[model samples]
Target: AKDNRIRFYTIGLGANQMQVDSILGPITVNAPDDLDEKILEKLANESGGMFFRAKSAKDLTRVYEKINQLEPVKIDQTYLQPKTPLYPWLLAAAFVLLLIIRVIQWR
Candidate 1:
């Protein structure tokens, strides 16, 4: 979001509505686990996009092919780095603790 040279093209996300913008649900039926289909639908319509639901391998492939055919979005991905330098240390501590416990029990 911070990048000025980027456009977002989110697709097939279960959390979002797949209204007119999606390429999977509008034309076909999806599986039971298809989450937030209505939301995606609403989002697509609101965003002035198309929505599609791919229930099978062929449909899924078709969706991808369709997506590829669309115009390219001009945006660069923002590289996010973790602020916690202690993350690696925490992992090491956990491994050492487990090793010490196993060694003590082996005696």
Candidate 2:
């Protein structure tokens, strides 16, 4: 990624343990411990990015918002111009055509 100038933002979600409900009752089991946060953090650091830990949906939303704010997209305004409205002109043309048709029919 460094050679290509690409950055990585890593996110780790959930806690060490999670609760699940079964026929027996509510049970607490170990969460997925296979997620190596150290590697995620290292990748973020090496790629000049950030590592975020989100325990809930709200935390994940906040992390996404933070990343969006950090890397904002720039738009070129020079190519933008005000829209030219042609509706009124088209309406007038239609009115004139209707009048001409009405006069021809009357005659």
Candidate 3:
């Protein structure tokens, strides 16, 4: 994920520090063990991000909130679609012209 301008907030489920370290960026490892301190200390040092160990549901919620805070999404623009039915009007006009033509032919 390079040169894409999109930052990643990876949540590694059941991954060890040795495995998470091999990856780049802010990665939260939700593993069985808490995680090695040496790895956690150096996690932000190299990638300029934080490493969180999600042990429970609350931890996972906090991690998601942190990620949202880091990368806040904003809508750039809004598009509106006009709601109009023109086909019925066109059909009505055609029927009126046909009726006029029939009256002229009868006269």
Candidate 4:
């Protein structure tokens, strides 16, 4: 981790809970279109972050205001992920299917 300092921000626009699940995990919201509340929750839960939604050009100004109001902070995250052989398996499956098709044609 060079410098060991980074900030991660997740933005969900007109997105349901499932869309944000992999990024933010489980979260409950009343409406998918409401950006204010969703951004608010994300900021609050993610270490005093900033939140805003742009419903229009005027709303864009408000979003900027929210960002300006938040104090500077950093978030550090680390996780373990395992790798599996994917491409080789797919190639093997395709090879088997081609062989089956060739045999069928010969029948």
Local accuracy by lDDT, each model: 0.62, 0.91, 0.65, 0.57
Best by TM-score: 2
Comparison by lDDT, 3 against 4, better one: 3
**lDDT for residue 93 in candidate 4, whole number 0-100:** 97
| Rank list by TM-score | 2, 3, 1, 4
lDDT of 2 at 18: 72
Q: Which segments of model 4 are wrong by more than 4 Å?
A: 1-44, 72-107
| TM-score, candidate number 1 | 0.36
Candidate 2 structure, TM-score to reference = 0.62
Model 1 segments beyond 4 Å from truth? Answer: 1-34, 73-107
**Worst lDDT 10-window in candidate 1:** 1-10
Model 2 segments more than 4 A misplaced: 74-107
Weakest ten-residue segment in model 2 by summed lDDT: 72-81
TM per candidate comes to: 0.36, 0.62, 0.49, 0.27
Show the lowest summed lDDT stretch of 10 residues, model 3: 11-20
Model 3 stretches with alpha carbons more than 4 Å out: 13-50, 76-79, 85-98, 101-106
lDDT of model number 3? 0.65
In model 3, what is the error at residue 61, expressed in angstroms? Answer: 0.5
Between 1 and 4, whose TM-score is larger? Answer: 1
What's the CA error at residue 39 for candidate 3, in Å?
A: 10
lDDT by residue (tens digit), candidate 4, 3-92? 333333333344343322546685665455545676566654565343444544565666666565554446568667898969998999
